[model samples]
Target: MSIPQKLFSEFLGTALLLAIVIGSGIMGERLAGANEAIALVVNTLSTIGGLYILIEVFGPISGAHFNPVVSAVMAYRGLLPRASLPAYVVAQLAGAVVGAWIAHAMFDVSILQLSMKVRSGTGQWFAEVVATAGLLLVILRAPAARVAAMVAAYIGSAYFFTASTSFANPAAAVGRMFTESFAGIAPASVPGFVGAQLVGAALAVAISSVFAGAPVATEIEPKPNV
Candidate 1:
């Protein structure tokens, strides 16, 4: 595919993913009526389904990389062209913001607002690291056809297991900063989350390289896990 086409896929996929995330959070929060656990469960299930569908829909066109870390890893492994990394990252970031705005619009909320939800601390950062590392490991190791299912399943599980609720994607962390909702993350907290995610991604890459006995050699890469 051409660079423009690939970028569009990345943008659209990311936008829809964020919409599913933020929109569901809003809906779930309202419907759960003070039940935080119930709201999270609803949000988690919707995200799992949305993520699986988006990956399957766009993976063939652009590898469905909606996360900057995933694009970076793919480029490092030579699955994606190094020159295209910037475009992919930009697309994902732009799509993320747009997605958040779209979600806010759908729910008749203020658009372009920053999150006030302060998610910080050692345990949260460490949880992000573990979540992101586990995510990358699953993506790197899953069979091509099973990438979507495995990734969605992992994120679903991580939602409950991780302290940060597993905002494992840097683009996702950035996106969530635009909403002041249940799934939102404070803008001030984004840097720490992103930093932890990058570290986790690096660790995953190193482990994958070692397990493969070298850098991955496949020309066709699997879909990015969230």
Candidate 2:
């Protein structure tokens, strides 16, 4: 797509993705009573559905990279221009804040709040590393036709398996930090989560490069503007 169109798609896609995540968490927490597991299940399912749709809708435009780390990896692999990385990151981060605000508005909560939920420690950080690595691996390996489903499935599965609920996307972490809902992560914890995610992304790229050769065209589908 054209640069403007690509950036717009990324912005909109990431906004919707964060809205789904935070909104679902708020809804689930309100309805699940004291059952944290039930709340998580609802959140996971909704996120999976939303993720699938967003990827499908935007993949043809900006390759649907709603995460800064993913965009960085793509640039490193030569699938994206290095000069485009800053725009992608800026769009994703801005979209994340907007998405969190929208979620709060939908839930009738204060828009001016920072998460107080403290998520840290070696185990949680390790989980982020593993979660992010697996996410990138799946994206790298998925066929063009299956990228949407595979990515959604992996995130859904990671939610249950990973201690940090698989906040594999850096933009997602930024969005969640702005809220005080069940999905929110304390602002203090964001740096750690984001750092771990970046390390994991780098590791995934290294391993994939060793085994999978150079990047493939499946990274994105053919688009007229692109």
Candidate 3:
């Protein structure tokens, strides 16, 4: 695909992902009232479904890489052109912000806001590392046909297992900082989360190299347009 088409795919996919994440959190919180667990379950289920669908729809286009870390890893692996990495990251980040705004607009909330929810400390950061590492490992090892389902399932599971609720993607951590909803993470917490995610991604890369026999061809591999 052309550069423009690839960027657009990343942008759109990332935007929709944030929308699903933030919107579901908002909806879940409003309905769940005092039950935070219930709200989390709602958010997890919505995100899982949305992620699966988005990957299926956009995987053929831009590899549906809605996360900057994912794009960076793929570029490092030579699956994506190094020259395209900057554009891909920019598109994903931009889309994440827009997606947060779209979710706020959908729920008739203020579009401009910052999260005050504190998400930091060693446990949280470690969870991010674990969460991100597991995510990359899944993507690297899963069969191409099962990538969507496996990824979605892993993320949904991580939402509960990880102490930080697994903002495993830097784009996600950034996007969540824009909202004060249940899904949001305070701006103050973003740097730590992002840093942890990077470490986790790096660790995953190292481990996958040793654990897996070879890099498995997956849906995330973009193809040239004929």
Q: lDDT of all the models against the reference?
A: 0.94, 0.93, 0.94
TM-score of 3: 0.94
Instruction: Name the regions of candidate 3 deviating beyond 4 angstroms.
Output: 212-226
- Tell me the spans in candidate 2 whose CA falls farther than 4 Å from its real position: 214-226
Candidate 1 local lDDT, 52-115, one digit each (tens):
9999999999998899999999999899999999999999999999999999999999997899
Worst-scoring 10-residue span by lDDT in model 2: 212-221
Clashes per candidate (backbone, < 3 Å): 0, 2, 1
- Residue pairs in clash, model 1: none
Rank order (by lDDT, best first)? 3, 1, 2
TM-score of 1: 0.93
Q: Supply candidate 2's per-residue lDDT for 190.
A: 95
- TM of each candidate vs. truth: 0.93, 0.93, 0.94
Q: Cα-based RMSD of the predictions, in order?
A: 5.6, 5.8, 6.0
lDDT-superior candidate, 1 or 3: 3
Top TM-score prediction, candidate number: 3
